[model samples]
Target: MPATDRSVTEALHKRRSVRAFTGQPVDPALLKEIFAAAQRAPSGGNLQPWQVTVLTGEPWQAVKDEVAARIAMGREGQQPEYDIYPRELTEPWTDRRFGVGEALYASLGIPREDKRGRLARFMDNYRGFDAPVMLFLHCSRIMGPPQWSDMGMWLQSVMLLLVEHGLASCPQECWAMYGETVRRTLGLDDGQILFTGLAIGYADEGAAVNRWPVPRAPLGEVIDWQGF
Candidate 1:
């Protein structure tokens, strides 16, 4: 079905963090159109602080190779520019995190005892789950929390746009774990901080990793109503 035929709510329901892709390349024109439209996403004071480096073909493969070499050498790549998660994550948040992870592995038939299996599966993230295109999001190092929030909003806009184009994506903060490597490879200066990577392509719908259901908390659990 064409994306234009789907409502926003339908797109939302269809969207998922697709971990496996068919390795099909998305049309460059479509990519440009999607991002151009995403420019309208709201930002405080109209500060369009998001910067994206889209990679495909040789450039993308070079990055995968470099990170793979680092993994093989027992290196941690580089010091992460920022924490991906809070140092003191607690309660229901931690439980939710653990639950999704367990569910993912279970979908792949990997038991908790199979540490190697889990690690191998995780390492596939560096390869971008075989997506033909990867986009690195970055912004000035000096940007504050508000600017960071703007980045998230822009990212959400991009993901929804991808869904509207019959494409799938995975927003990976794990890429930030090797921020320096990515920055250097892309020739981006230290003035900018790499935020995350988004893998975009057609999803491998039949893949077990893509078939698993990712649960979400009930609307009542997250939203509080005063008067409506």
Candidate 2:
């Protein structure tokens, strides 16, 4: 399968963090091709630090089972290797996060008072949101912040490629909370740190959870002007 002629702007506008996906499977060959294209992402000195563990079929089932079992035992797996968010998320950042959560729950018809329902739905993330394919991004402990930035670029490339391939994806940092379980389930060594997880498959367009659109700040607010 060749890369699509989809423009970068079009892909950006169309892409979102897809939370619900259908049971349809993505072809392994297409997965390979998309990741290969993602290799084109820039890295420091061409040292691409991103490593991926692809899961499907039985392996995928096993991962879900382990996460569920651990949760059932009243465990949240292990301490995260790194913080998923700042120690104190303040100002507009907090507002942005809160807004999305409210919008998402509203879309699902889960009222603000339904704490149990929200928690149960949030747990679905560990199961890859039932996506047909899951990808776990990993990087070496030896890598520094620069390499982590490189990993982000690589993942973004992969997400855009998924869109080009008529697929949807959700880059999940929530998996980082269960890093130890991911390492054990995937047989990854201590040298490798779990960065994030990506759930990929066709989107469930009819699902209300997928209908919520999170707002972004205006470019003028984020950008700083320089001398022209």
Candidate 3:
């Protein structure tokens, strides 16, 4: 409540997926600001549960190369310990998932039948889509689902903070599927598990992928008034 509601709500609305970015490096001061905002996110039982390893310069590119090399060998050798998606998705969730995928690929002229085309787009996630700053986020083993929810709140805080700084981000859960490799390479403790990665930087405005502004359903569709 420290800031005006309009500014807060407007920032939330303006946050979007920005894939392509110029090669400019994110400054340390800016990163400090973003992380500080991330730190302020609400937590469960006062357990923050989240840890972040940000990569840039040689380290970032090195991890990219290592993963790319593995992928080039036709093998995603290291597997995640848990499932990323439910075995079955039902109801409105299923429709929403499909719609998002359709909208995203449609922006790039990728047809539904083009399996390889879709794979190519996912492959971009591996390269951080050539993003300058890559953030690896993980949660501690001691935390449960509620704590995981807190981690998401923190992630959203980081995303909105980036937007306020004129930067864009993409929270890549798919990146966590390579949790083992990401952990080993990033020197994360074994007790910490990769939750996701965020691609951060100025979005390349001209890129086709950045043009996809996936729509959200109207408020009435998702919200119920208590006593309007």
TM-score of 2: 0.96
24-122 per-residue lDDT for model 2 (tens digits): 989999998888889999999999999999999999888888777767766544548799989899988998889998999999999999999999999
lDDT of 1 by residue, 96-188 (tens): 999999999999999999999999999999999999999999999888899989999999988988998889999999888888888888999
Q: Write candidate 3's Cα lDDT for 49-106 as tens digits.
A: 8888999989998778777766675654656646777868786788888898898898
Winner of 2 and 3 under TM-score: 2
C-alpha lDDT of all candidate models, in order:
0.90, 0.89, 0.82
Number of the predicted model whose lDDT against the real structure is largest: 1
Better of 1 and 3 by TM-score: 1
Task: Name model 3 segments beyond 4 Å from true.
Answer: 1-6, 72-78, 226-228
User: How many pairs of residues collide in model 3?
Assistant: 1
Question: What lDDT is reached at residue 212 by model 3?
Answer: 74
TM-score of each: 0.96, 0.96, 0.90
Stretches of model 1 off by over 4 angstroms after superposition: 1-5
